[model samples]
Target: MQDTLILKGHILHTPSPTQLVAISHGYIVAVDGVVVYCGKTLPSSYEGLPVVDYGDQLIIPGFVDTHAHAPQYCNRGLGMDKELLPWLETYTFPEETKFNDPEYARLVYSAFVRDLWRHGTTRSILFGTIHKDSTVVLMKLLEEAGLSALVGKVNMDRNSPDFLIETTEQSLADTKAWLEASKSFGPLVKPIITPRFVPSCTSELMRGLGELAKEYDVPVQSHLSENYGEIEWVSALHPESDSYTDVYYEHQLMGQTPTVMAHCIHLSDEEMDRMEETQTMVSHCPYSNVNLSSGIAPIRKLLEHHIPVGLGSDISGGHAVSMAKVLMEAIGLSKMKWVEVDNQYAPLTLREAFYLATKGGGTFFGKVGSFEEGYELDALIIDDTSMFDANERSLEERLERWIYIGDDRHIMKRYVAGRLVEEPK
Candidate 1:
């Protein structure tokens, strides 16, 4: 069953971190939702194919959000003054507690899906609260909206407020049920194991969740060493473990499965070595770090170590939905790190940051976030006419300006898996 579509536009994509390939008046040929050709001229064999042409608009890969919280959508920009631990106590937990009502979950999850669509986030990895029913509501909404995401049902059985904590038995049972139910979703929406963090989940809960992850063969997502308070708390909680990363590894959470850990701002040298050895991915959350006064992640060092890296909104804690803005902030933060650390870390160029937002994060999703042949055709069509000046601009300049200043209004259309995604009803 082949369904072929052709689109003509000013094409741009990063085949590698340092390479930005641009083709003027390019043609993209996709068959069955995967790219087959992207170049300035179409092959003669396909000359008769009908083409949808956008005269002067820009075409680029859609953004991939590596970490975010669906339960925290309503809490965006509300608790910026508090650090990670207290923020969770005062604002995060209370708001997440509201998800006990499925109606409330529908209202917030629906709006959150629309926000992701509007911002051109074709794919994301998200955290849902511990309530199984409410998390399912989120998965259904994302599926309906034609977005792709790995949404987790959070598991935390200890050290949490009574209102939000689950007993260890109930936690495992609920998670197993949720994993089974997630089978109802389309290919785009799936489940991931989520333990809130080491401090919130007891060793028993983590072990059970790890075993479930292996049994189901699903990937995992969780918070890492994001702040000084969080790191110290993990140390105190798991005194027997060598470090925060070690606790998860000891519990069979990291090396045994594909895992993405958020906000690795303070990883030790040994932890870094272990992360590389285990092939774990780091979700670099720049805005959340700044908002919570968490220190900057040493992304350049991580890159040099050949560790995988990507950008995340970490919404509510991050306060933004747009990965374009997230990548911009990543570039800015890297500059600060360069100066403050005496040039130990060179600042990221725009191309490098763009790569992080796209293919870097997209790697977790398999062939997503690129315009290369065989890559999933997740794309954004940009109408940057409003930002244009009388003076001519190159494609790279236009893309840079859009990344810095463009919003949803400039996004004329979005596509996930080569299917046009309309705004959700």
Candidate 2:
């Protein structure tokens, strides 16, 4: 039977990167987890169909985290003093190495899953440690928690510490096995191809993984031009390539399938052109960019080039999981970028950052992050009455205040695919 759910609240969503659509005391009707109507008044067809009235609460699309490392859940807020490569060698690798133990993976991932829920992230694309068992544990936990994600078992075959690195053959075999294992998961939790960036993966491994990505028809995620040192290192490793982005493109990792590259703080004109041509998405991780001393990405330039852009928490490196805070940081960083570059790029507006946190990132998952007809009904019901919220404030103003100052305490409820998502066990 097709289930129908009707909700009424102060609705807000971004239909475009620059537009915010708000409806006071709005009604949203979803049938079988897809939105059919959203407007200021209940349509007659939906009348008397048992409305879930939220009164004065704010109902908005759930956040989509385009880039995060599941195994780094325990590493947030640690080792922020160093730059990207050193920080990874010192803190990230050691922490990720521990995930080889299934027990540890479960303990950490359970909390990570709960936190993603707490932060109102209904969907995410995450990277796991090389251990296939541990990666699968994350998918299972997310499935049980009723959240959605594209979880990857990370593959790194070179230039990594011996303890965490995988042999080329083992990496490919494990990844294929893991991909096959992922078939057991529900639709909400599926597998993604992760190569852990070019420096950590060799030509052989990248080629093999790219072939597998095509065979399995799964989306790909990796890092790109995140730090100057990292880009320099890539140039040294692949002297024949034209640019850092060229390495991934040459390996068939970028243009061959649906891919989302994180950081992208230093792409050249050629790289940007290729990105636009291939329709690859950039996961703009503002917090991590500053935290790791990675320069700010030319997000406005990328947008002008018509490249897809989205927000990412990049936890551990970023030190936060809340997309609300991430979007605020994104706006703040864009302002800084505008000042740094003599106003060549306009700073991002509140609506634009909100779009990145919603439909901007949500585009990766198809028909997500909005109240438009045919969108998946992933939403957050926020009760800001306790936050000194005023009656006269507009919905946009209230949402801005919440983004700047509110925490999970203001989130009263979360919905994924039109179903109420209870706290994870």
Candidate 3:
């Protein structure tokens, strides 16, 4: 493949949360995997560069799914009527246990990656079950398909079912091995330490993993304050901690490394202060929050605190994989928070939601989620003619329609690191 490529399309990207940069007919030039130029017209200096003209199609930064469970793909859209704990026991754990079989993990993860690409997700932070080999299988599939990800071998030493539990010693050993094995993957396919959450991981295990994270210089991802029941359970489990965020901090999981805690829907003022102080990130999963009857996150407040916040699919908990769908749910849920709870926490703008799905979440992966110069070109090409978000709508209006109603069918092509990503066979 040529190192230099040019593309012409209707483009949309967010350089800032409040700003939506759109060009009705724009051209993007990339070379050696970095975007060199993106503007309304083809640069005159590059006269002969081959241009892939996707006339009238929407070209936006690829969506980033900041938190997803690869093993739970099978359980999506099923058992959603129940809340968090019961749903996990009945559907999630049993389904995740099936990953002990490598072939099962292979099938599920392959389909999951293809679906992620089909839905225009170019990067993600994904969780695998406790099976070490199966988790590696997920990483390999992601690497093969040209997707960027932080794939973790889940760590849970207690409070899990007997079939899924691990000894603290065994868990730490497996995690070290998993990290060592991940060195073989492409640069984009890195490993992260995942302790599952406060309830599942014992303090000893979290401390060990925290040490490993520091030693290896790897980032971490986990759930936080997702459910009231889960919070109560964590409180009961670790009474010495001042708050849910404090538990992770006390164990050295939050502040010592890059950490993203999902579904921060319920947090105390002190917890918020700690999160803001530590520069800890939050993966806001609006669909999961509402689906599990968890309270809507105070996203406006988080943004107000200048804390880094991004959108997540929260797979299985969130029934959809498309960030477009997540964006819609996020905006609607924000409205509920504003009218139903506090007017000071106003509803989120469409621009802000798009930023969360793209640039905001992309910050986790560094220099992704935009067409800015020198940024890796992970982009999506879309044909939204059929949806008509509105008939003969302006480019911005069409984008809004896509956010409100588009699906994978609207995505014509996807690219990661300037290389086109094909759907898995």
Candidate 4:
């Protein structure tokens, strides 16, 4: 029988909307993972089980990062002053090319996974380099580290450095092979279709990938409307398509599979409507947008349209793995957008931003991002005794402070599916 572990803390469960759940098991078998053998009181049967008490600490679902380029971990903070296209050409492409070396791939991939744990991000959707071996290395590290993630082998056939580009046929063949090889790894680390974006992927490649998504019943992740120049480039490349979103729709990559698009910064009504209708997800990378001057994503508009939106670090581009920082950045950027762009687009409230980082993104995985009954017990125990006072704040206030002011130092314990995975060094 699996050993039962009970964790007591101020649980921030993202059930329905959001709530705190008492958590137990490799699964959250009861309210917040607690199993009651008798009445409301502690049962005699559970007396032998270990109960870890986190006094007044905030316990939340491990953050779900919906979009990031894991392979770019080495290049973070290097080309911050440049815009998207130039940055990609000069720094990003060249850095990604180095992943072709399997040894180098292992070194960087290990660091990336460690960093994810250090930042308390238990689950994520990540992009890997183009080389098959390098991508496989990334998956191996994630599996070893016990992180839940969806990683993709980037597919780019054109408009890229020669070292990074692939023949369209070769790209498809390699992608299919990667997906097939990934099947044995089980649910923790899965494959996602990553086209790089519309400009780099031909219609044939996109359509073929869409077919694979349907056949395998897996999720697809890629960039969309991230920069003005990129959007124009996509438009010029696909003249027959109505807009950037239409290009993906034309290839049947939209609704048939779970799809996540990064940065919907300049979407039109038609594009927004299509995303909403298809149940697509958007990853809002505020720091990346600000860093590259890519323009702020219309998050308020997207939310109003009932689209699923989540936070992304977009590492290298965004320059941080801390979703706590991303949460603060998201709020700050939204306020800037509302003030400078339009008053109608109000800033995201602290609660709304927290919801996006935890439960909103956690929804991608069933019953994640909350402490509700029967939910997976993926959570983090934070220690904030440094700021505790005789006259204290509420649970929400503590959460807000953690998001705005806290870092990995506050994460005392990290748990996934009720299994203790990482404890602070």
What are the lDDT scores of the predictions, listed in order?
A: 0.94, 0.94, 0.91, 0.83
Predict model 4's lDDT versus the native: 0.83
How many clashes show up per model? 0, 0, 0, 7
Residue 343, model 3: lDDT of 96
RMSD of 2: 0.8
Using TM-score as the measure, name the better of candidate 3 and candidate 4. Answer: 3
**Pairs of colliding residues, candidate 4:** 13-19, 13-371, 14-370, 22-32, 23-32, 23-33, 24-33
> Model 3 segments beyond 4 Å from truth?
388-390
- Mind giving the per-residue lDDT tens digits that candidate 4 earns over 1-425? 55566666666554443343333222223333333221224456566566676766777778889999988898888888899999999999988999999999988888889999999998899999888888998898888788889999999998887888999899999999998899879667888889899988989999999999998888899999999999999999999999999899889889888899999999999999999999899999998999999999999999999999989999889998999899899999999989999899889887788788887887777666665555676788887778655766777667778777778999988877666786322
**Model 1 lDDT per residue over 222-295, tens place:** 99999998899899888999999999999999988889999999999999998898889999999998999999
Note each model's CA RMSD in angstroms. Answer: 0.8, 0.8, 1.4, 3.2
Model 1 stretches with alpha carbons more than 4 Å out: none
lDDT of 3 by residue, 293-314 (tens): 8889999999998889989999
lDDT of 2 by residue, 218-272 (tens): 9999999999889999999999999989899999898888899999888999999
What lDDT does candidate 4 reach at residue 417? 63
TM-score of each: 0.99, 0.99, 0.98, 0.93
TM-score of 3: 0.98
- TM-score of candidate 4 against the unseen true structure: 0.93
